[model samples]
Target: MNYIKHLNSVFELFTRDSRLNPTHISLYMALFQFWNINRFPEVFYINREEVMVMAKIGSKATYHRCLHRLHDWKYIRYLPSHNPYKGSQIQMLKFGTSSGSNTGPSSEQVEEQALVPYININKQNKNFNKHKLPKNENEVLDFFKKEKWPANEAKKFFNHYTSIGWKVGGKITILDWHSTAKNWMLKGEEIQKEKTLYGPSQKRDNLKIIKEKDYGQPL
Candidate 1:
């Protein structure tokens, strides 16, 4: 299978309706990438340390918290296991569905899991509005940074680029954006808007203009 095509398909699965938060979608996408390498459809293992490393997260504690959240949200199922070769047996993951109806330990059980609906990546890509910006790497980085984007939001920024048809050597670029990076900045702006309109959640406060930097000269 074409690797880029597969990756695009996986990404499409997550961003379909925006039902899943970006972080969750990213985590699932990572898992899908991992699955492509292992080819272990029935059983796959991921440990806390490994997850942190893959996610580029700083703290193991934070990784554990995220893991728990994923589990609680039914994004993946964790089966206890003990392996002499490995640290922990967090066996198997079921992606694309929350309902226990479609996947589980057995193939038959998996067949019962509900299949989540996702948009066609090809369709979205065709429909996405291409927002051209500066081609200078520094200018691009600075523009987003000036927007008060978190250091970890590189992925979403990269996604924006792909959505706009930017490519390098005919390959899609991967960004370093962490899960909450873009959402945090967007949420902050939303909060500011809400405060301006509703006179704050707690008290009436002066509103500050958050100037967004313009895209530098296009290439």
Candidate 2:
């Protein structure tokens, strides 16, 4: 599977669910993509730098912050990978139930669940500010008008949004548009609106098509 595309879809799924935080959701998306690509059934070692690069995070500190956040969220369980000679051992992270109920006899079971941490990404934050398009009435209308995006194309648009930054509120609004866009795209109507949806620097239109051959069976 194309890891990047799969990551986009998985990110969308998590964004739709209000229960997940942006950082934890992004970490899980990266973890799942790595697992799917490597096809490792057992524990796998991942370096902090690798995660920073994969998630497009700014720094080692930011990467570790997100990692700790995911651990505290119970989305993943990790431990130091053993090495004969090393400064800091690699990390082995597992994605799935950390509750131990889903593991088999041979599987590693985490006994104590860590207390969840509160890492809020609120609207007033700088990250959130980056996603807020012009809220002005005329500007908003003109933004959409220039894009000529069908109301239904919201899903594709939101996927693009969350891929760049976790815009939770924007995601909620985009989902509503996605529902509307689906019907229009299906009927092959609103071609002009569809063209308008692809704003500058937004490549949601160039999304990689996942063909049946790629799946090798019904998805």
Candidate 3:
């Protein structure tokens, strides 16, 4: 049984009732941790000072007020003790109970239903930034057109990722395709530098070939 979800169900009701403040919620959660540790027993003891510390309640007045508020609201049943050595016993409502509804389940049903549903950390994050990223090569090329990237370099970037199924470093998915395009532009600068370095040498060789052909012709 998912006790956290059970607590969440109780909290849903609390959301409807605006009277429960953050302080009340904090104190309730502190009690909840104790209830969980003590294995959902019929009655759990509370150490007022310790609970105050756990809930970050600054004063005894606020602590007792919220504690009694929870009790009075039927969120928990409080049994007070006069003895300083003995702590008060609390039975938290582990399942459905309206503030004043007669439809509160029977004790047996309440015991069975007290244990409830699960909370999920759904894997929606994979698709979270997908929309913001380029969907295809055309979009990628168009995106780089306004930037400093050459068209061919943009195409190379697009094809590189497209061939590899749009993943980065073989495993991690690229969340931003534009960043990859920028990286392609940076790498292209290195290629352009190499071409520029050898460009004059190629021109010189071409000129020598033309001169040799002219010298052999009719001079």
Candidate 4:
């Protein structure tokens, strides 16, 4: 298989897929790495724990769910094993045509053709901001409300991020504003829990400390 072509094709497919989350992408990449290590075998056996560690997945439920979803999406063929000594089997579905084929264009030609659309897309998006952001405070408020978050928290999130140029730690640019907002809410919850467990007079500087951490990076 042409590794570069395969990754480009799958990533292009991923862009069009709304059902996939970061966990799904992480798991898929981990599986792809294992497939690579095994010399791209037609089928391979994998230990659940080993895959989970490679994927940085802590929960088995999440790992299994994403794995099954990938299978259901026809990205891979999964064969679960009942025996404790044997690992589960996986067959990665190829997205690109075989490089050894004689009928198609040469490898260089194929690569160039595959990159043409991306070149056009980059040119078209030259003037557009790549990050996802709300048009206004109202949009942010609406999203928070939809997620059952406090209206005031929406304002806080919008104002805070806006002041920082929608970046985490005033350095890294945020790609998904919605996910950032969700993380903001989660941090707020943690702060609230801390206050409840200790006292209302807890130092507010802790919030500033938390905000200093880079939230733009994926978990």
Best by lDDT: 4
Q: Model 4, range 92-164, lDDT digits (tens) per residue?
A: 8877656532221122211111111112334323323455678999999999999899899999999999999
Model 4 whole-model lDDT (C-alpha atoms): 0.67
Clashes of 1: 13
Q: lDDT by residue for model 3 over 11-57, one digit each (tens)?
A: 67656665666787888888776566444555656656545555666
lDDT of 2 by residue, 66-111 (tens): 6765555444565543552211222224323324232211223334
lDDT score at residue 182, model 2, on the 0-100 scale: 26
Extract clashing residue pairs from model 3: none
Relative to the true structure, candidate 2 reaches a TM of 0.33
Q: For every model shown, what is its TM-score relative to the native structure? A: 0.33, 0.33, 0.43, 0.45
lDDT of 1 by residue, 98-125 (tens): 3424232222212122223343445334
Candidate 4 wrong stretches, greater than 4 Å:
98-219
In model 4, the clashing pairs are: none
Quote model 4's TM-score.
0.45
Ranking by lDDT: 4, 3, 1, 2
Clashes of each: 13, 7, 0, 0
